[model samples]
Target: MCVVPTVIGVMSGFFSLLPDLLPMILPSEVQITKASDLEAQRGGKDAPMIRQGAVIGKSDRMCATVLIAKPRCSSAVHHHGEQETIIYAASGKGMRHELSPGDFAFIPPWTEHQEINDTDENVVWILIRSGPEPVVVYLTGWGGDEAKADSID
Candidate 1:
């Protein structure tokens, strides 16, 4: 079994037993951008056009991220071992195996899935995934950096 160290903190100056006690903070700002902006920056790169901030990595057992995607943008079908995920749509609408905002879906370990934005505007969401060094394997679709890809596979 893989042993993942954990850290616990107290309100009044805490001590961390693990090698690292990473703090997860809610972003204070949200910036909206168009698909055109992403296209200009990527130059046709097959990457998720992130219009806002996204949680790419975290040191904790669970990592939370926020992402904004323009219409028609989709995530690749992927799966991982010992990892589960929950996605909450904050705004806009989309389809994820018959799921949308105000709707919650639990992706089990090794389950193949992807996300798509069908609206003309942007779709915003909060995603949370848990596991020790959780690995996400992309089966199909597009958009991910080298580090992100390496972590998943």
Candidate 2:
């Protein structure tokens, strides 16, 4: 006698974990943002005043940008409200609390800090911040007024 095989038993192995496998099996789109597409925005005087091209940009979860500090310049003391930041010295250097090229600093949320460039040449650094958005709150201190004066439009 011919017998009919059961569908449940045959398909159980393939569809039993449909929910768990759907996400992995789906296709995803990748975003590619070009450098020329980014808008040039000015960082606070004490911060690196960016010009020309942007290295990266703020995303829904993180922010990446390049800092271009002129000679004898330094970013004003500021803090990121809830975003932690990773700053890497990409080129040209001065002194960042004794930190130098190939070196990176981890800035915790709400930590006040500054980037100093006392050399005659410009200092370039890549600043990466983690959060839904990068929020900077400048701190007022001894040289706060001076920093404001140095700020560019």
Candidate 3:
């Protein structure tokens, strides 16, 4: 029996075309700069302002959103479905677990929780949750003021 080489094509032309077939990957530094530029364009001077970016509206799978919260800003005490979540601190400092960065606590389903940004700089974080859809019902604080009862329930 004749054995054939297991290797694919080793042509120089094919190798050179690899980059063309694949999209160029941007470094993290470049990505951070781009994000900063976008934020700068929409950023405004105001107290307790929220800049929601990405994954708005309704969807089936888990949703992802970026929340840019300013100082003294807080999201009222609320609870959602039996969905698990992880809030990642993207930048700046904040009081999540009544402490600094990497000090987050688990919030069980239907458990009421609120986040406040006490620092001067804006606190950016990613909210990730897996479920049918997130339905946050505000009981007290800022959520009680703006959101409708029907929307939350």
Candidate 4:
């Protein structure tokens, strides 16, 4: 039945049906990402050059992404415009303020902060934002020039 599978977060793929059945049957609001279908990206060897770009997208209400933090590096002080971000530590624990595995943190809309990883390994964080797309406004520092806010990622 759907009870146990739903409770444990198992996406039930239909056994036999028309080729277009899934798209027609499943509600568009529900996004089921299978484990094997998920993609993960990590920082490359020999320290990656600082980069910024928006890849995460939204179906309608929220946008989600998997961010891998480089070792011994921190994100630029930035804000998410009107979007709120929820972060979950997936790997390489001990982020700033000491978030361990399975830990979660919330960032309000337009709140400026950085994700600092002091460890030697890449840190992975699952980010879910309360908006239809990712919006990143980079700044020179906290309360610094908003004009330098480039890349709405």
The TM-score leader among the candidates is 4
Q: What is candidate 4's lDDT per residue for 1-153, written digit by digit as tens?
A: 558867545443444454558768774675565544343232343443223223345354687776777788777777899998888888886445788889999989988888888889878788888766778788878797664534323
Better of 1 and 4 by TM-score: 4
- Which pairs in model 3 have colliding backbones? none
Candidate 1: Cα lDDT at 44: 32
- Deviation of model 4 at 57, angstroms: 3.6
> What digit string (tens of lDDT, one per residue) describes model 2 on residues 121-150?
777777788865457666565335323534
Query: Is candidate 1 or 3 superior in lDDT?
Result: 3
Q: Model 2 — TM-score against the truth?
A: 0.62
Q: Residue-wise lDDT of candidate 3 within 1-153, one digit each (tens)?
A: 433432334466667887666545532232222466546646555536454544434445666556677877776667665777667777766644663545444557776677778888788777776664556667745345445666532
Model number with the top lDDT = 4
For each candidate, the alpha-carbon lDDT, in order, equals 0.59, 0.66, 0.61, 0.69
True-structure RMSD, every candidate: 10.7, 8.3, 9.6, 11.9
Q: What are the models' TM-scores?
A: 0.52, 0.62, 0.54, 0.64
Ranking according to TM-score, highest score first: 4, 2, 3, 1
Model 4 stretches astray by more than 4 angstroms: 1-26, 29-55, 147-153
Candidate 3 vs. truth: CA RMSD?
Answer: 9.6
lDDT of 1 by residue, 65-104 (tens): 5556677777666666578888787778875655566777
